[model samples]
Target: MQMMSVSALNEKIKSLLEATFLHIRVEGEVASVTYHSSGHLYFSVKDDRSTLRCVMWRSNVSRMRFRLEKGEHIVIDGSIGVYTPRGEYQLIAVQIEPYGRGALALAFEQLKKKLEAKGYFDATRKKPLPPYPRRIALVTAAGGAALQDMLKVARRRWPLVELLVLDVRVQGEGAAEEIARGIAYADTLGADLIVTGRGGGSVEDLWAFNEEAVADAIYAAQTPVVSAVGHEVDTLISDFVADLRAPTPSAAIEMILPDANELLRTIDELGEQMGRRVAQILHQKEERLRREAEAIRGASVLRRLVTLEESFARIGRDLREVIRYRLSQFEGRISPLERQMTESVDLRLRRSGEELRSLSEALRRNDPTLRSKEGWAEVLSEGRRRALESIKVGERFELSDGRVKVRAQCLEKRPLK
Candidate 1:
């Protein structure tokens, strides 16, 4: 027999137990469970016959998806080893899973229950999207197909909305953390809406959106957040916590953005309706005026008013005809003068337009030609200038540009001023 110190005996036992149970699976109900402040997990698993002490270091605990609870049946995979200091044998667990379900599934149920109790999925807490969001931020993987899908949908729908794409990992390790950070950062931007999503994939691939970190960030965002992950059938934790849930990345854009073509069509329809309404109003007003006028005419005391109105109407018709005839004659006369003055045709037209406006006002006062200071003109007959002394009384001459042509009999011969 070999004699050994207590420390050496415990060391030998540790080496023997570790070598014998290098890889084993133990299934039992959890008994005593403690999550140490040092980040290690200490627990015991027991059956009816025996109880086994178990310990998982912080490194392994960090990788676990679900929390362990006393009385829950679980299966731990690890090797048995001796704690040399305490001279006790224990199971140093490397991995743990629920007895009959996948760890991820159990984790999903647990987190969903926990967050649901916290009112994370309350519909009243979710924000309504702006009817016409001017700026939208997309939190997604920059190079992923999901980003491309969203971009295409947004461009096709509302191209005027400015899109800010924030790149982040959407899958694999550290993806949830990146997604959480991306959401929080996107909220700082003054985006009217924020969309975070990825393309459809397997459960493992889409697990980042199921993470609690992502859910927490989505809940805390100031901007309206839309979770668009996986297919219509696939729901995630982030979707529940987001302000809105879209079935897919492309669907998110379709849901939030107003279609440009649809808006244009609506505007055109409204304009047509407005024009029709205005025409209807004018027709109603005109009919009312005619009825009122006829009623006034029926009264003998107002009969003179009807006659005066008719006279004014006739005068207005005659004045309009005279103006038209004068304008036609001036078109030929003004072209030559405009060329002689070295003025642009547009400049002449603009000045003539102003003169026409002034002429309309002068017609109200029975004045036609009011000479401007710039140019002078003389009456012409058969392409020759006619002096006032050479014309007879009651002989009519055409006026050009609303200016009066004088007849010879109107004035005696006088020296020029």
Candidate 2:
């Protein structure tokens, strides 16, 4: 101490404190807590008797399940050490826990029960998963294992679906606010479905899901949501409020998809059933047609036609006989009349000829030859008489002359004597 420099003295003190407190547990009320931008956590631990400065490395801070805040009663496990450069003594806390029910935890539990009583977890409120979801929104840490698991499962089961990852913090201050904003953003992007959760962790690690803001956001989402937080045994408020809940991210995908083989088999079966029905209908129609044909063949249509033909033939024969009888009667009547007419005409002609002959004979009798014969006979008788008279007179005249001359001779002789 008399000859030691400041740096050497500080180093010696640091070595003494490190050796004195190897591992210890301290119970105190947290105060003046601060988180550096460097990712380290600093706080003061105070008991009734004393207070100590505590520092947790960024590595351990990253692993913490809960947020560190001032005025919270806590118990921590760490080692007391001296910082040689700063020449200060401090506690290095490796692990820490709240002494009672944490304020954040109390709030989470109260809100969860209230929402549950309002039927937020009711099966009736849950929506059905789409048969084929084309777009899926994811609300979780971009770098976390949860997002990776979801991608793997979605791609394996339904590769055709589009994935939209909305990266946001899953824990710590303002983490719940970021998650709610992510859910709203996904809804605006027109995601068909949403899968919101994180990898497995303790109750405090998954406290973001228990947030009132996160639950309200899930309930308000227009798209259907699938909650996959922690392992199967772990349940968060988000799981109850979402449209569907799965034990893990992989299970969530399986819940939403249909088996391709099963669907194809169903289609084939329906086709076969339809084919059989159509064939049965056709067969029935064919049988009906056959029956109709047989009925037509058994009917008496041909017999009716033959009867009609016979009746027509009988009428024709009767008509021909009647016409022949009428023609024969007409001919007989006309023949007698024609014969009488011929006889009458011949008789009239003969009578006229006889009358003409008689008239000609009368005319001949009164001709000039008869008159001339009568006249010639009269003339011959008259001429013969006249010739006889003339001869007698001549003889008498000759006698008278001779007598007169003899008488005259007697007288004259007497006178002369």
What local lDDT score does residue 221 receive in model 2, on the 0 to 100 scale?
A: 84
Instruction: Identify the runs in model 2 with alpha carbons over 4 angstroms from their true place.
Output: 1-108, 117-119, 122-124, 300-417
Off by over 4 Å in 1: 1-16, 84-87, 302-417
Residue-wise C-alpha lDDT for candidate 2, range 1-417, written one tens digit per residue: 289999999999888889888799888998779999999999998978889899999998876656776787888889998878889999999988778666456456667778988888788878877898888888989999888877887666667889888999998788989999999889899878988888888777888898878999998888899998889998888988999888987677778865556667889999999999999999999999999999989989899899999999999999999999999999999999999999999999899888888887776555435544444211112223222223332132111121121111111212224
**Structure candidate 1, residue pairs in collision:** 388-408
Candidate 2 is scored at a TM of 0.46
lDDT of residue 169 for candidate 2: 95
lDDT of 1 by residue, 1-417 (tens): 988999999998998888999999999999999999999999999999999999999999999988998998999999998879999998999999999999988889999999999999999998999999999999999999999998898989999999999999999999999999999999999999999999999989999999999999999998999999999999999989999999999999999999999999999999999999999999999999999999877778667779999999999999999999999999989889978777676788999999999998787554333442334446666556677566566555533434555433233344577
Q: Each candidate's root-mean-square deviation in Å?
A: 27.1, 50.8
Cα miss at 387, model 1 (Å)?
99
